[model samples]
Target: MTKFILTAFNPANGQRARLHYDNATSELTSESGESLVQAVEVVARANAPAVSKQTPLAKSSPRVLKISLGLSCNYACEYCSQRFVPRADETNPGDVQAFVDGLDSWVTSPPEKVEFWGGEPLVYIKTMRPLAEAIRSKFPNAELSVITNGSLLNDEINDWLDRMGFSVGISHDGPGQPVRGPDPLQDPEQRAAIMALYARLAPQRRISFNAMVNRENASRAAIQRFFIELTGDPAVPIGEGSFVDAYDEGGIAHSLRPGELHAYRNLAFHEIRTGQAANVQAVSSKTASFVNSIRSRRPASSLGQKCGMDKTESIAVDLRGNVLTCQNVSAASTAPNGQPHHIGHVSDLAAVKLNTATHWSKRENCPSCPMLQICQGSCMFLEGPLWDRSCDNAFSDAVPIFAAGIEFLTGLVPFHIEGELRDDRKDIFGFSEQVKPSRDRPPRVFPIPVVAA
Candidate 1:
């Protein structure tokens, strides 16, 4: 329940002001002659929806089903989370028919969305094709999606993808393609396939060039420009803009360095505020969610893992019916917490026990973190230096959103944060070194009465 005083510049008047923020309740109040607490409370009461409770794990059904094709890939992305994960025995097309047959008995209703996962899903096209076809036959209307690195796509594959009504995500790190591996764009065959698929799907709002932020490719504006130029569209939808989660030595090397934190935050914040990165979902969606959360007074308890793997209805399975903690980890792998990533087999859903993950409530820092609403809790099972580095990257990555969220709601650009939180995270955008806001002004006589949570 650490409450902190935050300093900012109100853009409207160019006057510096202070605001009190409660980490425990997410309450914000102006220390200027005016107050924001009353307005916040009023908005909270009027807009807050009844909390949407998560379905219990034991009684859950698949609403969003993610089928991991396997860990096999065509390219080696340096920071890919699954790059070094211990892979389970491969499941081939031979298992597809049985897996599809098993679905009818367990999956009572067609899942709203069915995602096919891969290191590069196209690597398993032989298996993927039959499996996808079977699922489509069973649930013709389910929103089928697949993510690929775009190296193996061709006219035949593109035609199959379009006919299947699948929404595709070409996982390309536009400006930083070299670091990810060989550039598929340079290969004429690969280039044509990618462009053809993009042309077909972009028109239907069914494709995105999912990009990740890393030390080498940190600029959202740059990433946006690269995609816009490649797609010949100024409004390309960019997904997965948040910083990467370090899973191995390569991932660790790609993560944000300690010295680069402030610079990255500044650039990210400026790009977001100036609208240069508006097409990126990570920025726009989060800003909207933060504003809405403020209006609704969304409690931190309602938050879940950023990946949604914690939700009972959001299930990830392999062809063998082995349920996993997430798509990133395989059934043969184990979480840092020493629990097997394999929660249970889909054949026995009632016997499933998801003991691999720890809720954010168990983490001492999350409840009081200002970024909890935005980050939720990254990589639920991450621990040791991986967790620390991931948390650090998450904080710097979120600082811009925090500033933008506050600015959008209050017309104030936060420059410095003074609170009971970490010493390093206290200053926002170097405001602590700047001139202090006037505390000499007479305190307003009318105090906004504190609202109980």
Candidate 2:
């Protein structure tokens, strides 16, 4: 309900501008009451999709279907979200026939997107192949996608994926591969398979090498350079180039320390402004969206979480028909607050509930946070220390991009956000409000950014 005062400075000179941002109304205006938006649309706050412990989302005919193949993987990445989730019995190829048979009953109509998820999806290729094939036969035009570590990719699998028009995302940490375990790029067979798949799918713009940034791998510029060099493609699109959320001990260990936030944001902003990360999907997509939000004066009431899983029409389920809060979790697991991840069964769509999550608006911080438009709150189900650490990482990670979006639209880089937020989050890019943008320059040159949930 409170409007935030943003302290911004034009890099051309030491001139400053004060802009007021209203989170609830999503209006941005200057000192003279000139709205950043040429026109503003006032939507009722009652329209906001608010979910809490008692008010959980209910699933029905879904437009976005996420099918969890299983919580099994070949490589145990240091910060994998599924690493600790209690696994149900492993789904096998035997379950696909029955899953496919029941899909029509619950699906009702053709889904817009059908994404296959796994601890590493290809780990369940046998089950995935049949499941995806059946879904494809039923809804050929639906967008089929999967993300993997690329260790299991082969010529046969690549060909099948290409024929099916699947959008494949290889999850590699680029230079941060050491911390993620074995590097597929280092293995001759895996490298060849990955590159071959890339060559086949790049023509259709269906492949992207996804990377995650953490305290250990904070530089998107470095990550971008690494992928471009490895792939020999100047414009290779990078996916998920955002900071990691702390799901467990490994995630917390890899999260940015309190002391590192300023430096990280500075480097990130420097890279973004210089176009070093222009090809990063997260950077391009998020910056553009943030800018549009300003132009439209997008109200927080219309916003959803970073992940669309909170919507009633966006549902995730396992092979056995167990509905989940999201793809990263398993039905056999329990959320940190003791809520069951297995909220319901797909057979009874009307009975399915998403109680494991709390919507962004339900959280005390999100409604007043400066980065609400871009962050929407880190992970809907995460709680306690994990949520705190994840929120910390997300704040520092978003500040630079938030600044970039403001700089693009108003020619003023935001240095501080004055609002009812944590004191440390006020000074963006770790520069005091008194400092000019030109004087508070990044130590190194070159860049580009993404907004992840």
Candidate 3:
């Protein structure tokens, strides 16, 4: 017998209600109250035809093991928070061993996804190879992925990923040259090499791109054109756009002018809408019709937010062994006191609690937002007192981009709903508009003011 789980949030009492349905006799029962069964029966009879089990939606896993392979990077992107560059002295065998050992224990207990992030993950391919090999051998079921600038990926690294069965996410900001520090546009050779590598790896690997949109590169027409060409295939998932505040440890590197911000929003929306339309066309006509209907009926506000790097869904570890709550947090602060204290091991429930608590406390403003579930309050490091002074800038910039994405995908939903929803579909877009201008807000910067040691 098939089962359907029904879950509803009771706004009046701030509680959750769960009900289960049995497909055989079309019976329903509430898991909590004694009268729940009667209520379910009444609803079941009223609805008739079918009864499905009420399974609670699986909460996202908060366990993310970020193995920071060291603070080494090849490209000098202007907005890079880590200020990363390839440094031989930074890589420590002892640190790597401790991290791997800690990860092994973490997987044994709660079992979480492992993400390799860094100045650039490919810098330590040797360390990564063995680590990936070990994790796949031991944890078989644990999800593994990597976030790299893609400047250093070669055939060997691609092969390693393919053999180990890992997903890959590459970072690039289309084409704009904001002088990183001194070197203008990241090495031209490096960029070309990355593109070549992507082309070669695209067919076999689950590859995605992350473009950090900012004022310098926010040309909507250019961005839309680039995305159209990049994700021409409907089957392939489109890349993501993240609005980045231009700055590093030094100070504000650049800020988006009001005009640039408006243009960027329009471009992002266009990309999303066009991308969805193309994807729907690739599917059966019957499905496309359904998508149109849904698009017409659904309120723009009703569309959900895109799934991003959430604390509950993922976390990051620094070059030392400090496990951070998320990537943005990892990027904002160097190991506290530069000692690299272990925040929490991957397998440790303590880590989950610390990360979750840190995330919740940092996201105090989120509880009131309409798009809380979708935004998950965005990156804490980007919000709060950590980096940007404005609480709403992150999501404010994100909403236009995210909403466009939702319109695009929902526009195509008619075609793919009957079949299994692709994992990529969950990456929808929706953002709230309750944002205050940074200039008008009180400054609450993080890495709290410390006297020079």
Candidate 4:
């Protein structure tokens, strides 16, 4: 079993621990101080499950299915995940009936959740309505969800959505509107329609204002406050709080800049701790999972991709029946790793082979990363500069949660990571000076700190 030293601090009481950690089988064997012994009970009770069982693509049946309408969208957000993806053949409302007929045979069992996708799903209102209607009829109890930019919503559309029992997510970067290209909130008609839909769905837990963090829109607390003020609801739920995946030039421009990683993590950790960003799922969920991993001693090998696209049972397909790599990419697109994103068609599930993705285990750095459980390998198919930029963003995004989780479990926030990982990654949240060499081994002088871009 590989062993490493981890240094952390408890923000609550400013207590510190230099703990011994096992990598091959995850466990915190001991701490420098005897005072932490009782508080370590949290680790024993966490008991997080291993990653989902893997199955061959040909034999798997998905419980979570995403249907892609098309790549068509109304607004051009600078950092949209799909901005650079290649477009596939467009499917129209006419394709819905055929798509519905195929599902009975294609889907081995009823999906628990069916997501309607598009560049802006509402942009294909014609196709979306009929397709959603068919899916609802087939899987009557399934959770139907859609994410739209609020520009197209109206009384008629909102009423239809309510009747259909859909959980809607409206995409808006509240305070960072200019970077996102347009503000649907600025238009009087769109604003009214958005409020109307919000009024209709708020009580049912069926609506949320989806937001993403980028260099320009870095503050979750600020984002939350803006939404709360705009909606006049103090307890508004926010979705998609993770950092933006850098896809192209536009995406690169918005990704975290050099030396900003430490600042971002500090801000994020403070916001999460103060409950200012409690509505953000990315913060709350990651913090919980990270804490449980430590408590349960979950190994790095048990971790899966951040997006479950590597799982055979998490499927994405178009009305034309072509199964795709994931919802963020289209069938016509090719992954940066030089593989086509389209795996196979639903008509021939047995022949399908998902060659597009590389699991976290396959990534060169993932296994050694202290943030493996948190970052989980950003974007399975991204490669080259895109992958590099995304990995940078993931590192900064996860460090705060990493520190918070450790603080919760052992009252020690990890200021630095030391062991099998690269020398550069050992410093957590840019706190390189805090790392002290083990007394048993001679200390090797480290180079000057290089800020991650």
Candidate 5:
């Protein structure tokens, strides 16, 4: 029988829920199934438990590590949650080495995958190269990826990436006039550069676009059309969708106008339902099923519910070797007393403790929200000055607006109706049929050379 393991890491409770599966029988049964809450409970129990016990569970290796190289970024997007920028004097080799060493030791057995992230990873390519090389040498089996802006990509970087079998996730805001800041490149030039990279590297490497939806771009139907056109190719991976909420200078949540908010929600929902968006295609069948199951348990008011930073599979580390509990918060807040915390230099393999209690909590307030299952208590950093507090008002207000928009968009695409309405007979989101056609659709032609695999 094919065996599968499912583990749920609850940072809030500092506990895990693990399930072992028998694929042949399509059943989840554990060695301690009778005593476990669910089949996956076995896997969770293998990690930390929600409740304390005399004999602690064996620690399981993390399945993925999201290493945040630093807070430095090239763009100053208005809605940026972390508010990161390249700090000229902040990049330290000692700190990078410490974190690398810790990761090497922590993952001696290694996880299923590892991803490198940054304000812009290319900025520190020199520092990152050696580490990437080391990881490749140590864990040949690990799936490696880098989340970058793609502005600094060149032949040399591309060659390195090809050799490492690295997957690339490029962050761009479709063809809407630059809302985040000045265009990284001027009009035609910018588009050309982006397309060039896509053509040269996409076939050989797994590449996808992450587009943040906001008011300026979402308001323009042309922008959405441009997105569809840009990523429509079968060979070229397309857009990955994410919501960008406007924030005030103090980092407090700012209210979005009902219409603007509605537009953003509509676009995201439309993309998911129609399979017009990018990364949606790449989401695993199992993970998609899990998300749909959670959605079915909630009412219409919580469509975008469990979608946030915490549910993500990666963790963030900074230039100073500080391991951030969550990347959504500013660097200062991620550290103790709002000061940066360092794990160790890149060369030392030491375990580090995160004071998660301060930034994460699951309270009564959360259970009452209709989107609780989907949202899982919202962004940890957005809860309050201390992470433990609940953002009750924010949760209640945002759910309905988002849900309405999602529903409206899904309605526009007839194919998704059965899936959205929870008809068991239909495949989840009608994914099997819709996604393949959408992906096979012809892409708009561009001048760049399509990279050969």
Candidate 6:
């Protein structure tokens, strides 16, 4: 039951207040000991579930089954998580049937959501088609989804995806597509195919343009504006608007440096409050969850990894029937923590032991950090400097949402959180003076190329 003292101000009148917060109970109170929030009608999240490398979670039938087709992408995006991970033997069309035939053996019931993964899923379209069709036939009611670079989409593939009830996510870095070595958008045929696929899926509300926030391209508002203008839909949804995890050197290069945190948080907070990043899921969902946490007294212990891969009900696998820690790695690869990516095989579901990843509760600073609820301790499997960089990036990314959620419920903007954290993280924004801004100032914007033709 750790608690922290907070300094907050009303942006409306510049009136200041001191508050108390209990992380375990999600209780916020005024300095006089009056509760500021009433718990909403929901089950209490008293303690976070503890799963670690030593005390691991086991896999059975997954509610969300992620099938990793292989790690063979056409375009190498700069900070791709799967880019440097060791690849297993490439999955092919011939391997699909045996894999599908074996599903019922371990998957006790149909998953609520089934996702096809890839270095690029479209790279093995032949294998993907049969695998997806078989799964769709078996679990017609399950939600089907995929994230693609959109370089290989053609009329037939797009039509097939549409017919299969897929929630398609096209991965693009908005103006920063240059980080992705080849510019498929520059090619007429590839660009046309992407648009065709988007057009085919947009009406059903199953399509999203997924973009990641890197140091060079760090504006959720700009990313939102780019997609909205590109699709000509004011309500176009944006996915993966959060900071990228540092998987390797490329990732660390793009990750937010310590010095840039304050300005980024200030800019992000400004954009979020101004409604510029309203279409972004990272902003909307994080803020809402924080508000709910305070209302529900959500304990730090009930939280899992941000991706939920730590849950027993979520499983990742490849065509050869090797169960993986998550869709991002292969059976042949090893986690940074010295555990094998191949946790177990599907044939022996009961023996599946996931020692590859650590949960948030097991990590340092997570149990004490104010952003614990919003950030969820970054990626579950990362370690060393990569983990540090990812954690830095996540802290900056979540600060704005934390400030916004507090302002929403208490009408007081959080400027500083006096807690067991680094001194720099205590400030919600760059301002150390604690004075309210006289007016909203726009953040600096990098010049972007006009819409891709």
Candidate No. with top lDDT? 2
User: Candidate 2, after superposition: displacement of residue 265 in Å?
Assistant: 0.7
For model 6, state the Cα shift of residue 316 in Å: 0.3
Q: lDDT at 239 for candidate 4?
A: 85
Tens digit of per-residue lDDT, candidate 3, span 111-153: 4677776667788787777777776776677778887776676
Q: RMSD in angstroms, all models?
A: 6.0, 4.1, 15.5, 5.0, 13.9, 5.0
Query: In candidate 1, what are the lDDT values of residues 249-276, reduced to their tens digit?
Result: 8878988887788778888988888888
Residue 20's C-alpha lDDT in candidate 3? 40
**Residues forming the 10-long window of minimal summed lDDT in candidate 3:** 48-57
Segments in model 1 whose C-alpha atoms lie over 4 Å from true places: 32-59, 437-453
Better candidate by lDDT, 1 or 3: 1
Q: Per-residue lDDT for 315-414 in model 4, tens only?
A: 8998899988888788889876676788888888888777777676766777677677788888877778888889889988997777676667666566
TM-score of each predicted structure versus truth = 0.91, 0.94, 0.57, 0.89, 0.60, 0.94
lDDT (C-alpha, whole model) for all candidates: 0.80, 0.85, 0.43, 0.78, 0.44, 0.84
Residues 1-453 of candidate 2 have per-residue lDDT tens digits of: 578888776676646677888776667789678876665453344355777668888898989999999888999899999898898898999999999899878998899999999998998998899889899999998999999999999999999999998999999999999987789999999999999999999888999999999988888889999989988999998999989999999999999988888888888888898899888887888888787777776777788888888888999999999999899888889987688999999889899888888888888788778888888878999999999999999888888888888888778776778889988888776546335334365432212222221
- Sort by TM-score, top down from the best: 6, 2, 1, 4, 5, 3
Which residue pairs clash in candidate 1?
Answer: none
Candidate 5 deviant stretches above 4 angstroms? 1-61, 84-89, 92-104, 185-193, 219-224, 231-240, 245-255, 258-291, 294-315, 327-351, 356-364, 385-453
Clash pairs, model 2 backbone: 271-447, 271-448, 272-448, 275-447, 276-447, 277-447, 282-450, 283-449, 283-450
TM-score of model 2 vs. true structure: 0.94
